[model samples]
Target: MDIATKQPGVLKPKVGSRSQNIMASRVVLTVLMFALGILMILPFLWMISASLKLQIDVFEFPIRWIPENPQWQNYERVWAGRYPFYRFYVNSIIVTVGATSLVLLTASLGGYAFGKLDFPFKETLFLSYLAMMMIPPQVLLIPRFIMFNWMGWLDTLTVLIIPNAVSAFGTFLLRGFYEQIPKDLSEAAIIDGAGHVRIWSRIIMPLTRPAMLALMIISAMWRWNDYLQPLVFLRRVTNYTIPLGLDFFVQENTAQMNLIMAAAVTATIPLLLLFLITQKYFIRGIVLTGIKG
Candidate 1:
């Protein structure tokens, strides 16, 4: 009986020790993650600090997190200067919004057809479509430029918007989500006299909000940041998007780091706002996108 009582006492210490080990490990992990988060945000913090500082203070030995005398005029020079930076904002917004909308519409329709509909040579067509993605975008740049020139679209925002409107990746993303949706839902809709258009818009589209948001975010980011295509196509300074506009600012104000940083901060606000608003749905969409039927 004394031995049996000793066995229970020994087991209690082992269990307590295991719990303590787990708690210690968790505390260590939490500290590491917190450090990493701070590290990742440091660049943005530096940018903001530099934006508010004079050019001489930007590369100071011991970085100041905040400037003693904030130069709010850096932002004023960027916005009110002769460069027409506000026009760049308008052009970027137009192209990004237009491309993102088109991507969503086309990707949803194509995904619905591929994932839900019965048709001849469907797999072969999809494979062919996927094959297009393998071809280097640079290889087609010359041809696209020639085609745009022929169509009188060069130096226009249309050149920027049209190429990005259809996205192979977006279709692939939404198709996976669409496939996981039960066929019974579409069948029931059909029985209720709903056609393909109605089914796609009313029945199927509502269930795939997460995937749609993911695609929208992806397409918008791509269009917003595109430089190469705009550089190759756009000639007029008036037609420049944010990336091109920033490039122009950098060229003209090479010594004015403060002004450059201020311009960058202004350019980044829209994307930051977009993420802050839709991050919840974006995360949900990304998680649900991978689960297969």
Candidate 2:
């Protein structure tokens, strides 16, 4: 009985020590993650602070997170400057919305077809489509520019919208999500005389809301912040999107750090708002994709 009691006492301390070690490791990980988060956000915090400080105060020796006298007029100057700032917002919204909508429609249809339907050369066609994603977008710039020039689409919003409308990444992402869905759902609908379009619209589409929302957010961010394509395809001042317009603003106001930061903040707000609003679905979609992948 003494030996048995001594064995329990030895094992209890070992188990307690193991639990304490795990708790210590967890605490350390939490601190490390918190530090990394602050490190990553420092640049953005500086941008916000600089936007509200005087030009001289922007890069002061001792950084001030909050200025004694915040320059509220910096934002006013950015918006009311000689350049048409609002026009950039309008152009960006138009291109982003148009491209994102088309991405959703095409991705959903393509994902459904690939995941649910089988036809001649189904695998071959998907592989070929997937191959396109391997090509660097810069490689297509010259050819796309030539084609757009020939078609008289240069310097027009159509050039922006049409090229970005179809997304290979979205199709791939949604296809992965769609494959995880039970095939029985589609089979059941088919037995009831439902067609592909009907089954996709009424059933599969609703179930993949997380994936679809994730695609929308990703597509919108891409189109909204695209710079090189807009720079190459667009020439007119009025046709300039936010990225191009911001470049022009920077060039004109190079010496004015406050106004430049203010412009950057203005351009960044929409994206921040979008992510904040859809963050839950966005994270869920990413997790599901990883799990299904």
- What value of lDDT does candidate 1 attain over all alpha carbons? 0.86
Residue-by-residue lDDT tens digits, candidate 1, 1-293: 33433445567768776566566667777798999999998888888899999899999979988899999999999899997689999999999999999999999999999999989999998998888868888998999999999999999999998888887878887788888999999999899999999989997899988678877766777799998999999999889999999998889899989999998887776677777898887666555544521
User: What is the lDDT of every predicted structure here?
Assistant: 0.86, 0.87
Model 1 CA deviation exceeding 4 Å by range: 1-14, 286-293
Best by lDDT: 2
* lDDT tens digits, residue span 43-159, model 2: 888999999999999999689899989999998888887776888999999999998999899989998888888899998989988898899999999999999999999999999
lDDT for model 2 comes to 0.87
Tell me how many residue pairs clash in candidate 2: 0
